[model samples]
Target: MKITRILNKIDRRFHPSHIYALQPDHDLLRENRTYREAKDIVLLSYPRSGNTWLRRLLANSILEAQQYPSSIQSDIPFETVVPSIYTQSIKPPCLHRYDEVCHRIVKSHEHRDARKHKTVYLFRNPVDTLVSWHHFVSNSPSLLQQFPWVVDLSIDEFCLNAVDGWAKHIQQTRHYKDILLVEYEHLFQYPHQMLANILDFCRIPRSNIDLDQIIDNQSIRKLKSVTHSQELRKGGVGHGEVELRPSTVTELRQYQQMLNVAWKPQVERSLMTAM
Candidate 1:
């Protein structure tokens, strides 16, 4: 009761927009069991780890299976329904109710609750990730406007943040226990069979989405080539391989040496175990 009064006082003291600012209207997440009751799946991944394409494929599958009436985008729209989701929004927005959809699969780059439902963590080698990310951010003119500094920094400078500092945001999905780590190479190499493993694990049935049709689409086919977007860049699996000149690698190796202290091992072990 005292805590509630204090919280209320804090709420009353600040501007509602500031107090909640971009937050959804949920008094207490304690009662929000949507993510908990999810008999479905959360398609979790770092930005540009083929999550968009995966979601597309999943949407096509659901459509083909005839299990759903709308696109996968419609089947699960988290920003619209979930509380405090403040990333990018979907155009021709997806919308749904938990009980109504046959299965709801969410694509989120957000942090996960270790206590909640299943997760699929898709990743790529960091160099490849940076390459794809450069294209992704540059191509979206709006994002380009929002984050102008991204353009100012070269890949090496940018990676200092991705690798040097807050790298955990991308690397660790933190404590979600049911993560299935899928590397980008394997996904490209075996889209159908890999997707099958994901579906089967989630208990979703195999989809009738023409495995060939979706794969055959030219855009989908071309996604493999980072060069496809030259203005953005065309870095690949081992781009960093070349970028790390002998001196750079030596200096960078020291940074890792510093990071490889007593506490770091335990932390990495814990993160990998969760993944």
Candidate 2:
């Protein structure tokens, strides 16, 4: 099994046919299928909602605190540390260890029932999410071709559709046994404090480095420079207000208000404890 896990890692790394491919492997899911202690932390969000950015931040913090060799730390891909279940196999060698020395951070865009994992739900303003998602899908030739109507939809129409999806996701994930709500806007506004809350939620203590230093080192610009990733767009607040029609903005805000009402207690509790 150890050899198989190693092979799986190599297969994913090099994608050579000679190596064994264990992708689509449900071993981890099946192994952790039953409810147990030490549940993995899931970083949950909708697409284009700052999942990658937050993942990078979490991964950096974990690696530093765990005292992983600087060589591996420097070269290890983000997915190697915080993998996406949608794309990466779960049976990689890096994931075999489960302890304080090696914490698991998984990225997920979907929710499943009957799981006992702790979740950190990244909530972005739906209006901003709608605009960002539109640009994201529109830019992809495959997505545009598959959903031709997507290109034709007005911002209002897109917002209507996007809001429904957001509501459904929120409704689905709200019932998780353990959940932490981290607002995208608040992360930027109160980065140092918000990051501390997130680390504490995930049980990741800061290394000798200060919290402000961690935030400074993991800026979007630095991450982009390191990974050369184009997925990160203009990250801040008020994109929806700037681009969407007043009516559309009003509708999204109404839905946002409803969500706020639903999760107000959790949000308030997290805020109070964050300090």
Candidate 3:
């Protein structure tokens, strides 16, 4: 099987794809994009949140203006996708403080690091995030270890973590400006506008990018058919009870009871949301 991994902008010698940092620390040099020079527009999100499709659209839009520069884009994904082939890909190795401009397009599930870089944050209702996460990463030996709760988590327990938000504030925070908080629901409904916003964030020229072409683009289909297939579903509002066993449902509720009441509605809504 062919594993998909693409190296983004990074100084290969100093910042290998093996290491990762919350924010890049590009150093200075004559031939590289220093931290000051790294004009990055990153896509931030948790797993299965649809950034893959977003990134592709951005790539197509940018490539179109460039006019088939030399075979479109060679294959994207910087750290996250590249490391995924190993089965437990989490973060990439860190690079030196300079050469940050090596890859302009990047995708990561790691909580956002670079506090100042422009970012597009995508969030799914915690319920779906958790359910899909469990299904997608259930087989990942890494997730099993990182999230000990997952090993023996009852369905309810699973829901709690999903909604509790990731360690770095999936629920709320005020870290940086230029962030576009995109709920998963809007992405499917307004695919074009969503794409436009992303390009806008990246400061990418939008002249040649066709939003419709991207939605129907082969890469979108390719990703769904490949490793990312689990995400094909867009999600509804509620009713997981329909598919889960009574025993499992009971177990899930046990954990759900642990969350703050404020987040309950959101979590409950996503459980049944098929996306």
User: For residues 52-89, could you state the per-residue lDDT of candidate 3 as single tens digits?
Assistant: 55655555565555553312233543223222211222
Candidate 3, 151: how far from true, in Å?
Answer: 3.0
How would you encode candidate 2's per-residue C-alpha lDDT over 1-275 as one tens digit per residue?
A: 00112112211122111111232344544443232235567888777788877876777666667665332125666677777665554554645343464457777665652257788899888888878877776676755554566666676766666576676667777668788888888787777878889988877877643666667767765655555454677676886688888977888878888888888687777777776
Q: Please, what are the lDDT tens digits per residue for candidate 1 over residues 231-275?
A: 224423455547544544454445445434533454444344423
* Sequence-dependent TM-score of model 3: 0.58
Candidate numbers, best TM-score first, in rank order? 2, 3, 1
Error of 3 at 63 (Å): 2.2
TM-score of each predicted structure versus truth: 0.56, 0.78, 0.58
Top TM-score prediction, candidate number: 2
Worst 10 residues of 1 by lDDT: 1-10
Instruction: State the displacement of the C-alpha of residue 185, model 1, in Å, after optimal TM-score superposition.
Output: 1.1
Which wins on TM-score, candidate 1 or candidate 3? 3
Off by over 4 Å in 3: 1-38, 69-103, 145-149, 218-223, 226-275
